[model samples]
Target chain A: MHNPSQSGASLEISDLSKAYGSFKALDAVSLTARQGEFLSLLGPSGSGKTTTLNMIAGFTSPTSGEIRVDGREISTLPPYRRDIGIVFQHYALFPHLTAAQNIAFPLQRRGMPRRDVAVRVAEALEMVKLDGYGDRYPRQLSGGQQQRVAFARAVVFKPKLLLMDEPLGALDKKLREDLQGEIRRIHRSLGITFVFVTHDQEEALALSDRIAVFNHGRIEQIGTSRELYETPATEFVARFIGEANIFSGTLVRGDAGLALDTPVGLLPVETRLPAGRQASLVVRPERLEIGKAPHAGSDPHVPATVRDVVYLGSNRRIEIVFDDGRTGIIRGSGRGTDVGAGERIDIRWSIADGYVVPFSSSQTGDGHGS
Target chain B: MLNDTRLRWLILFVPVAVLGVFFWYGVADSLWKSFASPEIGLQNYAAFLQSPAEMAVLRRTFLVSIGVTAVCLAFGYPYAYLMTVTTARLRTLLMVVVLIPFWTSMMVRTYAWVALLQNNGPLDRVFKSLGIGGLALIGTPGAIMIGITQILMPFMIMSLYANMVRIDRRLLDAADSLGASPAVAFVKVFVPMTVPGVVAGCTLVFVLSLGFYLAPVLLGSPQHAMLSQLIVQQVSQLLDFGRAGAMAGVLLALALSVVALGAVLARPAIERGYGENT
Candidate 1:
């Protein structure tokens, strides 16, 4: 019988904040996720992603704020009463119990019939593709096997929300990728709300429906992977998410709308910012095009000399020094041109290809804001 | 490789020589004294084993040791668990309480139990005030159990605490997050992980209790005489070296057998218990 309450509860976290004396681990953070959506909290260490997950799992109390599941507030409830499942970084499986017994724990605790518990445990083992590993203790199993057991144990009780905190951190690169696929498959089949936390950008980009980028105890931006990559809200998000070359200059009104006046000459921008204020040009490396002569169009063409070329498998990163003595990098397929060091080149990028971030020029003479 | 082997053998040779001199050498001399003196050929061994009176005392010794073990486990397990869960200051306080008993002399501890359990003593006075003096427990089997448990309780708690500290607390957290209430998680996850400690503590207390002399003398009457009392009497008052040597040999064999049997039973648990095992 399907539970009337099993409606795939949507999660709403509001104004969640945590402080350890003077150091604020988490600021007023709020987010919402539709039921059955896989959302990832992506950030560097000490950026409060784990703290937010901890608060949602009821492991730690928020200094102030509330968490709601389908309009039900569960801020003060104990962990066991909150009906949440959590997978830790270390597997944390019961060392004395076999894989089957470990999965059977929560079901048995809920007073489910003994026969039903056994049936569900076997079902869960099958779900993780560990059907025959029921009798091995944690020490006897491989790291990947233990990881699957931990995942199986968390979901066997049919929790409507699963929070995983860097669950693949301890495994090698190959196994991490392997278990990530398993986790994505399980999330699809379970149809429950999934909130994952990780610092790896590629993992977050590959697995999340929407990624909330965290920085200094705040969520800087939350959106689809392409949105965050193409147009980040701040310089911090641009630098943290992936490789980028940022150019700072004064914003000026131009025929193309707002253009940034830097040492390398005028460059077009797509965003609105106060004229004459110090702003930044956030350009993804792949957006820049290099050739012997710049392509003629509405794009901004600048002159540069190739200083070094690094050969990455599918692409080559052409490190260049502009004529203005400022450095810039252009990533492109190495097949395009046989450009070598000391070659004069021209780089072209359309105004819409990059973003502009304006900061308070009052904060610093150099225009870097806190 | 040859030099390494020679150095390793030299390192092992010291303890082997020490055991040979004090343990095997003493055992061979005692065996000779017991069997050869007062006419050889198993005469004294046969005499001691055939006496029903001495057999009864041996039987009682085992019963008392078992009783003491049970009592220690009942109190020691909770005390050790408390040490694991408490705050730092409270843990220090509990540790002091456990180690204070160990610091006291065994004779003094036995005498303390006697002082409290005797007629119209502090404990009996409380019972008398409650009009239950008819249940006077002094100079009985219960007194010996109480006295021995107090003396041996420290060893049990320390051994248990050592193992409990190594248990990954995150396992309990994982259980709680999986929808187990705190009480259920503790019973199902935490307690099973501490089996090695329980087995080790119980064996230590039981084997050590069999050789107790002071507590049984002070707290128990002659009607409840144990094997240790018989061995002590044979040597101290009767001056029967041959009889005492024979009885000492028997006690040594019993203790060794208990340890050997325990090792055989506990091997699997030691190899595959709570933490990483290879």
Candidate 2:
């Protein structure tokens, strides 16, 4: 059944729309996934990430759309007939069956020989490193163990595609990180297409080869993590992906790129932008430097008061009160930074580290960034 | 601290005293009366055990009760599952329909069954209209079974529905995504999860059927006399309180044993269900 030459399957979704009465859960959503790629649907709560997943999994029918797997339309197929595996956020293990029986359920349904079923079940359990726990019922297992059993059951059938809906959302931070690595490793070993849904930006960025950031039933941006983080097309993407310090200002003229004239000073833009456009400059917290010697012949120097200083283990996060009264964060190695609260300091960043995002009136007012 | 302790003991003792005087004393008095009658040496119990007529009634009662409980479970489980999976409005309507039969008295419900099942009643009339013969449905064991099932089905459905509704829906979805069909998911995931409710409902229906009087009295013939009807006959007609007490004791013992067995059987399922859900 293994076909090395036909390893990848392309999934194409076109103009998918789903509505619960008047409320549009998913609106004209469309995307494509190359085989053997890990794609994440990243969004906040009620942002249609799970809806999109349900549609792809055949658990839900889109109001209007088409889904084609390897160029074969499967939009109307039932979930079981679709031959796709899914892992839920709650790790829904069968309570009556032991881990081995749960993993063997699909194989048994297909009427495989008893000996072959046993071997495959054992292999699946071993793949999840749960070899010794085959006889344990779901209730006897811990949360992480149950999640691993769920993963084993999903992958036991070697499905063409796998859908995971916030599968690690219930685990603790340490466990979540551990299982994230485990899931990535499993994906690599299996070389199966995986579409994951998560509201957690860090998890999505860490695991996804490409991510589709969703907001209010629409895709704000879809790109690789580096592309989305370094050059976000919209303010939502900029704020959702990482901590972005946004300064609302009008674009000003500069020799190399556009500059932002804000309450602090003229903030130089990292990426070139159209001049005289109303824009907001985005600077990642780690990119901004505090208490460093000024670069030679830099034009803009914004002096600000240190509102607060938080001691992170690796770096000191300093909150600066700009001359116009907005706050910005700057990260420095804790050893060299002696700037305390109420002290005046000069905060600066390299011109290439700050980029301009289009100013939107509906953006959140928290100036300390995303 | 001393006053608080005294008040707490006083509060606890009040209910304990009330229960002891009002409940335990009556049962103990009945047990003493059962054993101590007509020369007082387990004569009533020996007579009850030795009499084939009495033994037949006991056997028939157990059979009928088991039959009724089985029927209730067979029908109630799917109804409960549908209630859990349906939309909220439809579920509420279905629940109301299940409960609507309970608002009327059991005797009235039994009489309604009589009206529907009698030879010249609506059921027979419908059969006759279809060119079929009028069937014998009343004053038989079948009538008693139907009446009991109709009255007892709600208890099973409501109990099972409560448990089934509380099940995590994600569990069912998970089974589906793992390539199990709907039927497989229901049998593997849902049926096992609702085992506690099924056991509870079965126990309740069985124990209640064991002591049934009205439905059997009204719908069954003299040959189909249940334990409760026999006890009433011994006390009221034969004026044999000793035999009646012995019969009552048997019924109580059977009911208690069944309840204990049910608790023992249901504990693991309940623990596993709750454990997995949590």
Candidate 3:
């Protein structure tokens, strides 16, 4: 009978930093999650996303800055006093406890009456569609069921903020997709603010209302999934979030507001940066049109050889190697003019589709330059 | 030849025959001699059971075993927990410390205890300096308990540590995040998970203590003799093989019962602890 929306708390973390000797795991990271918002901290391994979540959960303390929950500072508090619920990647269900007992643990810790604890445990089990599985131990359950029990145990306490650290990372692809839907449904019904940490970009985009992309102990960008995918703020975000063909070059001011003067040609970009500054123009695979000859349009086109052509049911993914030996991908309709490998083709995209972002050292290493 | 079934059985036979001759045959002989020695009857068991002196020895043996198990558990749990929590280098150092006792001769260690507990020895002198004078400890149950506990402590820590290291420490963090205090989580979650180790360690120490001959005899007196001491007395002094066999049979039965009880109590916990963690 607990009202989750009423109990939801706004979590604001500002200038949080954790230093282990000389290495800073979290360096001045700041973000906020409004009440009932589903925010995801998305990053690769060692990107400080999990560190931020641990700081919020009070498992890891910050060396400096504040963590405020509903306007109350809780940075110095122990994890038990924080009243926060966390679901670890390993599911962390008490192997000794049954599913019901695992859900009842938090309530029992709070000294809830036995009758109330049992009822709440039953409700939590039912919430996760595991009502009849209450008596089974974690080992007796499947991985997906165990994760469901973990989710139930985390939220059964009606904690204002719930943090999940790669909770679905262990499950198979099919189970992960199924649980993603279930998680969305649960988040909607419960209305508790959730901060999920994951390295899977598609999982972040499909599940989060907003995502904070992290890299090298810092947040590269934070925005809606559409905004992050369409207008990524930095070269790293563009490469990390999704497939992008980046044209690295110096920016030049032409008849178009700003364009990237690359090795291939001058690619028109619909983004603003200081003229003559080095930058990269990011273009999505789906936005690019590929054909044997240049289609009549004002969009800038690049000549390339089709290296590989993958046929999906509804779309064809063509891997093209540019004249400069850089590879790019273009997703077009499955039906085409029979584009084959080793065939010459022209790939073009409109200026509005090309996003310009400032270049960084990380972009030059491996993924972005490709 | 190695893959042949008969050859595999042949390879397995040598050790089995050695154990049968050297170990099981002696055990069976003692068991039969308990009843058949000095004519086949129940007189040895009855006489030993009816004698208040013998009964006192039996009761004291059990009490000492239980005391040793309790003392080992009390100290070893924290030590084992510390071993699990410390850094790998420190844990290795602690492991070496525990294993150092195992490397030395038990007799040597018990003799060392005798020197320490003797009148005006290092321990006695320390006690006297601390104002606890006239503390004659060498021939007391306290001295024996200390000796046996030191010898048996390595078993307890090793068992507890082996079980504790496999425990996913994140479960404690999960408990803390669920609003359980550190102490509550340790008692309810951590301690319960370590029950298998507790059972294994306690059962081993108790069973070993029941048949202990060296520490009790060296550190204790005839007045406070344990069951093993009385059995040795019947054999060496009285030359009463019947009484000695009866006492040995009783000790073996008690040890077996303790082992069976430990297995029964610990099976469910061990199974639950080692469930299929995908």
Candidate 4:
């Protein structure tokens, strides 16, 4: 049973920034997590997700920021006084300590009675499904088992907020998937707020109630997994969260409300960006309909040559090269006539299906569409 | 592959041949002389066991070696820990500082200590300036310990540093996140993990201290002669090879037993602490 006082704590981090000389690792980043919220900070490597996690755990002091837990400022506190639990990428389990002893370390430090410590350690072992592994040393365990011990050790104290920095990054895929489900179950049962940092978008999408996408030391966007996938705010979020076919052009008013004029043709666009401004139209592969010729409907269509087709069990991934020499993918259903390489085809999507992002100067020449 | 194996054996045979001729042969010759020289009997051993003065020299040698080992560990543990935690540039500087004594000969360092520890030397003048004059440290066991600890510290540091470099420092951070304060984390987590290093350093310093000769002969008084001094006096002054051989045999046995005991004490800690899989 969880203690009533240890249910969860709301975390509010404001204007957190860390600068080493002129290079800012985290720049004026701000975010919050309500009690019992499962929030994930997702980004590529060196994107400040880990820096934000370390600052919350008090392992690193920010250049300027305030970290508050349940309205109490803990920015100036030492890590031991912060009472936050952190799980590292490599499980930092004490090799000399047995599973039970490692789990009991925090409780003993808190001056719990010895009898109570034993009871709590036993409960923790069972909680991590390591009931009989209390006597074994860390080396005697497999990677998955050692990580389970690390997770048990972190949560055995029942800290209000838990911060994990790529906790599953060291495990194999099957083990990682299993642990992800275990982590979600534990989060729900403990009802504690969790701030997890990871680079894997699928892991973030599978785990978090709200995902914060980080890039270049700033929060690109923060929203639920579905919201991030369906309606990304920027080109970076659109490309980073999932696959997107991007077409860069100037926005122009067409028969449709707004269209992007590109080398191939005018593509339908949907965004708040005014006309005559540069923008990029993002279309998900599944939204684009591929055919030998233009469909009977009024959907905007563009001619493209098929470059390759990879058949999945349920669907096929068809890679197509546009007339402008840019590449795009289409998730063709299993029923389409076998489109081979070098075959010309027409691809179209409805106006509402295209999402437009303001074009910036940074998106050129990276060869991102492949 | 057969030629490679033959070449490996030839390379190994070189050291074994040299040791067999120069080292083990010498040991066997001395053991034989301890029993056979001047007459066939245990006369040299009985003569050694009979003399209270000689027995006192044996006891004092062991005591001084233990004291030197203890002092070396007290100073070297923190210094080696500092080497592991400091930046790479600072660590290289610290390493060079520790090795400066090693660059010079041991005799020269011992003579330097004689100057510092001798009566009214630089150390004495400093004490006098501080108004704590009349402290006679030069001829005492304290002076001998100081000389030997400084000379043998590099051995202790090297042994400790070799083992300490492999320690994963993030365990301390883990301890901190688990609610242990810095001091508690050091004692409960960090210190225990470094047990192998501690054992290695102590064993090296203790064994080296047992065979120490020049430092004690130069810095220590004749009235407080160590076992080496007694063996040398027996051979060079008393002209008794049998008695000297017996004393050398005793020293070798003492060093071997200490090393074997250290291995016994350290095996479990080394196995448990360095599993490293986690």
Best by DockQ: 3
Consecutive 10-residue window with the lowest summed lDDT within model 2 chain B: B269-278
Q: Residue A124 lDDT in model 2?
A: 92
List each candidate's DockQ score: 0.60, 0.63, 0.78, 0.73
User: What does DockQ come to for candidate 4?
Assistant: 0.73
Q: What is the TM-score of chain B alone in each candidate?
A: 0.87, 0.90, 0.95, 0.93
Candidate 2, lDDT over the whole model: 0.83
Off by over 4 Å in 3: A1-5, A255-258, A295-297, A364-370, B4-11, B120-134, B274-278
lDDT of 2 by residue, B1-278 (tens): 56988999999999989999998887776677789865577988989989999999999899999999999999998898889879999999989998899788998999988888888889888888888885768887789899999999999998888788778888777777766789888887878777778878898999999989999998888987888899889878998888888988888999999999988878777666552121
lDDT by residue for model 3 (A1-370), tens = 4576686789998999989999988899999999999999998888899999988888888999899999999988999999888999999999889999999999999999999999999999999999899999998899999999999999998888999999999999999999999999989888889999998999999999999988878888999999999999998888877798988999888985677889998877766688899998889999987767876776878999999988886788889899999998888784453699999988887778888888876742433311
**Which residue window of length 10 is worst by lDDT in model 1 chain B?**
B269-278
CAPRI-wise, candidate 2 is medium
Full-model lDDT for every candidate: 0.84, 0.83, 0.89, 0.87
Q: Model 2 RMSD to the real structure?
A: 3.2
lDDT tens digits by residue: candidate 1, B207-230: 999999888899998998888888
Per-residue lDDT tens digits for candidate 4, residues B160-261, read: 887778877788899999899999999998888777777778888888888889988889999988999998898899999999988998888989898788
Sorted by TM-score (best first), the order is 3, 4, 2, 1
